[model samples]
Target: MLTISAKEMKDVLYELFKKYEFTESKANLLAEVFTQNTLYGVNSHGINRVPYFIETVKKGIVKVNEEAKKIEAFGNIERWDGNQGPGIINAVTCTNRAIALAKKDGMGLVALRNTNHWMRGGYYGWQAAKENCIAILFTNTQPNMPAWGGKESRIGNNPFVVSIPRKEGHIVLDMALSQFSFGKINNYKLKGEQLPYHGGWDEDHKLSKNPENILKTEQGLPIGYWKGSAFSIVLDMLATLLSAGNSTYKIGLKEHETAISQVYLCIYPEIFHDQDLQHTLINEIINYTHDVTPSEKGERTYYPGERAANAEKHNSKNGMKVNKEIWQKVLSLL
Candidate 1:
C-alpha cells in the first residue's frame, strides 16, 4: 500500500491517455474521471482498472477516437450509439444529456449502446446530483455471475445506481447484483485477506470466503440469492431493450467485454415540488436514518453516500491510499 496524491495520479493518467492518442480535452476528462473515482474510494474502478482500459484500447475493444451519436429520439427519451468509444466519456455524455433533458421536461431517459465499462457507476449518479437532479443509472456487463441454483456464470452482475440531491450530501445507492464484485474480491486477495462473509462457491461447490477460490470458480453469489439473480436478469433486459444493444448472452459471444448497453434516467425535483421543501424532506429522511441506534456500541449509522462523501473530503486533504503495485503500473505507463 502507498499514499499517492490525487494530482500525481491525474497527471500520469492524463499523460498516458494522451500517449494513447486521445485528444487533450479527452485525456483531461479521463484523468479527472479516473482520479475522482479513486479519491471517492472506488480504486477498483479507478486506478486499478487503468491498465486494463489501456489494454482494451491496444486490443481495439475501445476505439479511442470514436464518439457516441444520437440514433433516435422520441419525447424525452433518446437512444445513442457509443460507436465503441471509451466508456467513461460515453457515460459522461449520456449523463449530461439526461440532465439537460430532465431540466427542460422534468425527466429524461438516455439509452446508450455499444459502450464499454463505465468504471464506477456512482460517478454518474453523483454527477447528476451535483446538478440538482435525481438519477437512476444501469449498465449490464459480461456474464460474470451465475444465476441462482445454476452452476457456471450465466448472468451479469449488473451495476445499479440511484441518486437524490441534498444540500448536505447526495443520497446515492451504487451496487452490483452480486454478493461481491470481482474487483472487491481481487482487492481482498491482493491484501491476503479473506472475505468477511461467504462471497461465492469454491471448486468443491461449497460456499467460501476465500477470494482465490471464488475467483477460480467464477461463481460469485447473488446479492439476495434468487432475488438478486432475478434483478440482474431484468436489469439486463431493460438496458438491452432500451439501448437496442447487446444483452449479457450476446456480449458473451464477443472476444472481450465490449459493446454493452446502459441507461441514464434523470429527474428534476424543482419541476415537481418546491426546491426548499424537497431539501427539507430529504434532510428529514437522512436525519431519521442517522438517529437510529447502532447495532454496535460506539458505531454511528450513515446514509448510503455519506461514507463516500467523507472519503472524498478526507482523501483530498490527505493523499489517497492506493495499491503499490497498481500505482507503479500506472506510473510505468507514463
Candidate 2:
C-alpha cells in the first residue's frame, strides 16, 4: 500500500484527466470525486476503477466533452440524454439539476439515459445531502449477477443509494443488489481474505466465501435471495421507464455496459418540516439506535454515513492508503 495525501492524489489524477482532453473544470471535478471516494473508504468505485475508465474513454465507449442534453420536462420531473458523457460529471450535473428543481418545487426527479457507469452512485447522494436535501439515486449495470436459483448471469447488480440530511452527519446507504460487487471481490482477492459471509455460488452449485470461485462463476448472491432479485427487476423497470433508456436485457446484447440508465430524486424536506422539528426527529431516532446495548464487548455503534465521515476525516488528516500497483499504473499515465 502507498500513502499519499488527498491533495497530491487528486492533483495527479486531475493532470491525467486533463491529458485525456477533458475540460479543466470537468477534470478537476472528476479528480476530486475519485479522491473523495478513496477518502471515504470506497476504493472499489474510486481509484481502483480509474484504469478502466481511461480505457473506455480511449475506446470511445465513454464520450469526451459531451454534455447531458435535456430531453423532456414536466413539472418537477425531467429526462436527460447523457450523450454518452463522462459518468461522474453527468451524475453531478443531474444531481445539481435535481437540487435546483427541489429548491423551487420542493421536490425533483431526474432520469438520465445513455450514461456511462457513474463509478460511485453514493457520490451524488452525498452531493444532494450536502445541499440540505434528501436524495435517492440508483443505476442499472450490465447483466452480471445471476438471478436467484439460477447459474447463468441474467440480472444486473443495480447499485442503489439513499441519503438523508442531518445536523451531525448525513445518513447514507450505498448498496448493490448483489451481495458483493465484482470490484469488491477483486479487492478482497488481492488482500487474500475470505468474504465475511457467503457472497456467491461456485460452479459446483455450492455457496462460497471464496472470491476467486465467485468471480469464476459470476453467480453472485442477491442481498436477500429472491427479494433482492425482485427489487432489482423493479428498479430496472423504473429506470428504463423513466429514462427511456436501455434495460439490462438490452445492454447485455451488445456485450458492453455503456449507455446505462440512472435516476435521481431530491426532496426538500425543510419545505414541509421546520428545521427544529427535522433536527429533533432525526436526533431522537439516531440517539435511540446509538443507545442500544452491544452484543459483544468492545463493539461500537454507528449510524449510516458516520463511519464514512470519520474515514474522510482521518484520511484527509493523515493520507489515503492506496494499492501500490494501482498507484504505479496511474502514475505511468503521467
lDDT of each candidate versus the true structure = 0.93, 0.91
Over 152-262, each residue of candidate 2 has an lDDT whose tens digit, in order, gives 878889999999988789999888899988889888987889999999889897999999999888778888999999888889999999999999998888756899999
Name model 2 segments beyond 4 Å from true.
Answer: none
Candidate 1 lDDT tens digits, 113-175: 999999999999999999999999999999888898888788999999999988878899899
Clashing pairs in 2: none
Identify the runs in model 1 with alpha carbons over 4 angstroms from their true place.
none
Backbone clashes in model 2: 0
How large an RMSD does model 1 have?
1.0
Question: What is candidate 2's local distance difference test score?
Answer: 0.91
RMSD of each: 1.0, 1.1
**Clashes in predicted model 1:** 0
